[model samples]
Target chain A: AQSVTQPDIHITVSEGASLELRCNYSYGATPYLFWYVQSPGQGLQLLLKYFSGDTLVQGIKGFEAEFKRSQSSFNLRKPSVHWSDAAEYFCADYDSWGKLQFGAGTQVVVTP
Target chain B: SAVISQKPSRDICQRGTSLTIQCQVDSQVTMMFWYRQQPGQSLTLIATANQGSEATYESGFVIDKFPISRPNLTFSTLTVSNMSPEDSSIYLCSVERQGRDGYTFGSGTRLTVV
Candidate 1:
């Protein structure tokens, strides 16, 4: 019932170009959102989290995400993606009962 | 944020065998959790490992198949019993951060079942 959806399965961005990954959540109450990145054959690293207050949350590695409650979306954005930023991104939503549900994930490929 | 040290970074085991993964947190946490990530799939909650109580498993996950133990506030273990090829996955341990912090995860253990 409570889940996040990532419409984009894969995205290719120029090495220095801006990148945006969309995430939409379906939950009744206020949602706790988070963004995570995973490299190939590595564990997941938390990018940022949005519990309350700030609509725009900044994260590590020059990444940020804006939580749009009206749209039920928390999308991740980066000004200029580097080669090292090429990895899979996941959007997660925590429900009222403390259950965290993750989206399908988006794989971004940075090209020069 | 709490740091988690997970054991058996990678392992290959034959079918019908079992493997146990351990997670040790740097600081004591109120809530600890386990997750499973199948190849090319997102994470699925396996169970919630709370200290001094039996682990609460999610739908489709049973204690007999995936037993969990939380001996204390900073330690936990998950055992995949009677493993099959389908059980091969990357298992991760997570700790709930206090206040605004969402959660902290471990490096994860990559398991391969032959």
Candidate 2:
């Protein structure tokens, strides 16, 4: 079975500080990884995705993710955190049927 | 990127009632999916709505409980039958754009079964 794991449930970081959210996946084949962010009372917005190209993928809202095949992980990273960056982040991978299997999600709290 | 519109943004329904959520896409999509996100939890796929055929439900989900309909490539509906307080959650509709890696999601319908 394909599964996604987000180790951190909640993380707090100061504004202008760097951020990194860890994500790991369990799959037999090459995974199609994605990162999405959801603000309170809003819909999900796609941050980035790694299908079959470069390990480092850039996404909207100054977000980026690196897919590490060796570790079966695709973690999201940002150089500077902002107050608007406080949202729930979700990591996902596509299953055999091409349906998305999502992680438990990590809630990022940016403190000023 | 595809845009999705979902109606009934928030509703408080009585137990034993049913709620049907509608999803409309700006463009024709190959795949449409329904998902459930419980409070303080991750999103769980409910079913894949296929046009012109029966919807394919994921494990732990059933057609009778969460019936879905996809009459065309750009529209679909998901009905939560015989709702209970346990069924209170945010329901989202997603569309898979062909050749796109990520799916586009709706604003979601927050259903509260009281």
Candidate 3:
């Protein structure tokens, strides 16, 4: 079974500061990694995804993620975060049946 | 990305009752999935709603509890049967769009059981 692990339960960052959220996965074959963001009481929005191209994939909202096969990781990063960026971030991978297996999610808090 | 919508964005139901959540997509899709997000927990896939076929449920999930319907490429529904306090959670419907680029999810139906 494929699984995702987001190490940070909650992350606090000052506005306009750099941000990075750690994510690790456990899978036997090549993994299809993704990052998604969710606002309070809203649906999830796709951040980025890594399938078979360049390890570094850029996504919407100035977010990006790098997929590292060796470390079994695909961590999300952003140079500067705005207050609106505060939300829950989830890392996910595809299962054998092509269904998604999601991480516990990392809650990002932007401090002014 | 695909535009998605879910009905009854939220509902509070008495215990032992049932609620059906509807998911509508703007275009045809190959795969439709139902997921459950418990309070403060990750999204747990409930089933894969395939068009014209029975849904495939995940471990610990039964068809009797979560009956799903995928009538066509752009419409699906999930019914939470015999609700309980434990059933209170956000139920999301997603579609696999653009040949697996990513999943586009509905706004989610927040269910509260009392």
Candidate 2 C-alpha error for residue B104, in Å: 0.4
Of candidates 2 and 1, the better by TM-score: 2
Supply DockQ values for each candidate: 0.72, 0.89, 0.91
How large is the C-alpha RMSD of every model relative to the true structure? 1.2, 1.1, 1.1
lDDT of each: 0.91, 0.92, 0.92
iRMS, all models = 1.1, 0.5, 0.6
lDDT of 3 at A35: 96
TM-score of chain A of each: 0.95, 0.97, 0.97
- Deviation in Å, model 1, residue B34 alpha carbon: 0.4
Candidate 2 per-residue lDDT over residues B1-114, each given as its tens digit: 889999889999999999999999999887799999999899999999989999999989999999998999999999999999999999999987567577889999999999
**Candidates ranked, most accurate by TM-score first:** 2, 3, 1
* Each candidate's clash count: 0, 0, 0
**What's the true lDDT of residue B58 in model 1?**
92
lDDT (0-100) at residue B106 of candidate 1?
92
lDDT of 1 by residue, A1-112 (tens): 6789999999999999999999999865767889999999877888999878989999999999999989999999999999999999999977656767688899999999
Which candidate comes out best when scored by DockQ? 3
